[model samples]
Target: MIRAALVWLMLAAPLAAQVTEPDGFRMDHYRDPVPETVAGGATISPEGAYQLWQDGAAFIDVLPHAPKPANLPKGTIWRDKPRHSIPGALWLPNVGYGALAEVTADYFRRGLTNATDADPSRPVVFFCLNDCWMSWNAAKRAADWGYSAVYWFPEGTDGWTFMDYPTEQVRPMAPQPSQ
Candidate 1:
């Protein structure tokens, strides 16, 4: 029985490691972390997000930006296909994890200011893909920046799409270089 238990423990070791491992680039593969609070904002459901939207909350999409093609031939017209988000959501790609950096943080601040018209009291919701941490981090950043009302829509674009909500195609703005 002891030998059998040892074998089982060895088998479970790798699975335990996998569970605790930090996700690098693939943020959409795991389940959302369960906590009463994230950063400084509270997690919100899709229905809650819908209500917030109806109440005139600003929505920010914090999905990672697709990398530019490295070796496009000269004169090749390389336009990005329009990306879709929950209707009225501003596509602020690369504002998730990158916002942790000082330069990117400045950019996020500016974007949030413009999105909320510099009104710190305005309600703001942040989201990315379902199960993604980018929105969580961004929402926290907003709260840290002294925003009065900040929320994290953990259900993200996937959840919104799953609910058959209407989406609008949007063009992403180029990020300004960090000064």
Candidate 2:
């Protein structure tokens, strides 16, 4: 009986680890919501994104900004670094996420208005890292805000890079003050 119990524990331990292991650096977590039907606009593929880009779509990157490191040496000089994005994509960080907090919504609205010159008919595409919800939410919000043509690129920057699509360096937008 003692031998059987030991064997069972050994087997269960590995299984438990596998079940509880964190999904590390993978684009598979949080299944793509609204895969078949976007709330307001259509979900697009990498190829479609490229086509829209060629047609002059306004690509928006909705990836959240990584917090800046703190505790640097007082004299440490930080230079402006180039961040990469789909060519011509406006880096509107922090606008994506399933929940449209008032602050985030305002940022999205302002970004759209500023980037597209308040033209609702302008073609717009929203994306982030693959499988992230930020792009999904942002695209929906644009459509809800009366944008006539909105596209959600489900295959995000990863997919774009994988396809060898052109990327350009961009600076992220500053956080807007909360209402």
Candidate 3:
């Protein structure tokens, strides 16, 4: 009985931490173990994403940006953290939030349009970081928006750079005021 109980405890430990995909966007705990499958899109590995990149699939990075703290003392200069992503990738910061503002939604739509040149049929890859749900949410949103070919890279830049792939510094897209 003791040996059986130990084995059961060990097995249950992993399941305790596993997070299942929800029917809708993940509302909290942005950094957590994501579900293996994204309902409406394909979950891609680094190698597969690299191949698609070479074939002209657009990559969108959804890592949120840190806005400068308004409480900073006068004369304090704030510098944004530099983000390095796969080459030719567009960094669409903050669009991966569980819920989006109207402006943010418009920004996302505009970014997708810009990436695909207004073609919904073009393949687009979304990613943020390893174990991040933001990319998963964005990928589902794309598929829901009628994008025919949407790919989600769960491992993101960390996985890409782990394989010694090249990376380039990228800036977030600035949505126009009209958007």
TM-scores of all predicted structures = 0.74, 0.71, 0.88
Q: Output the worst ten-in-a-row residue range by lDDT, candidate 1.
A: 17-26
The TM-score between candidate 3 and the true structure equals 0.88
Candidate 3 lDDT score at position 56 = 94
Off by over 4 Å in 3: 1-18
By TM-score, the better pick of 1 and 3 is 3
Quickly count the clashes in candidate 3. Answer: 0
Best by lDDT: 3
> lDDT tens digits, residues 34-109, model 1?
3335655677888989989888899999887776698988887877766789888888887777326676777788
Off by over 4 Å in 1: 1-36, 75-81, 176-179
Give candidate 2's error at residue 28 in angstroms. 14
Shift in Å, residue 60, candidate 1: 0.3
lDDT of 2 by residue, 104-167 (tens): 7787788898778889999899998776766776777788779989898977888899999999
Alpha carbon lDDT of each predicted model = 0.77, 0.77, 0.92
Give per-residue CA lDDT, model 3, range 1-179, as digits (tens).
99999999999987876667798998889998898888789999999999999999999999999988989999999999999999999999999988999989889999999999999989999999999999999999999999989999999999999988999999989867652
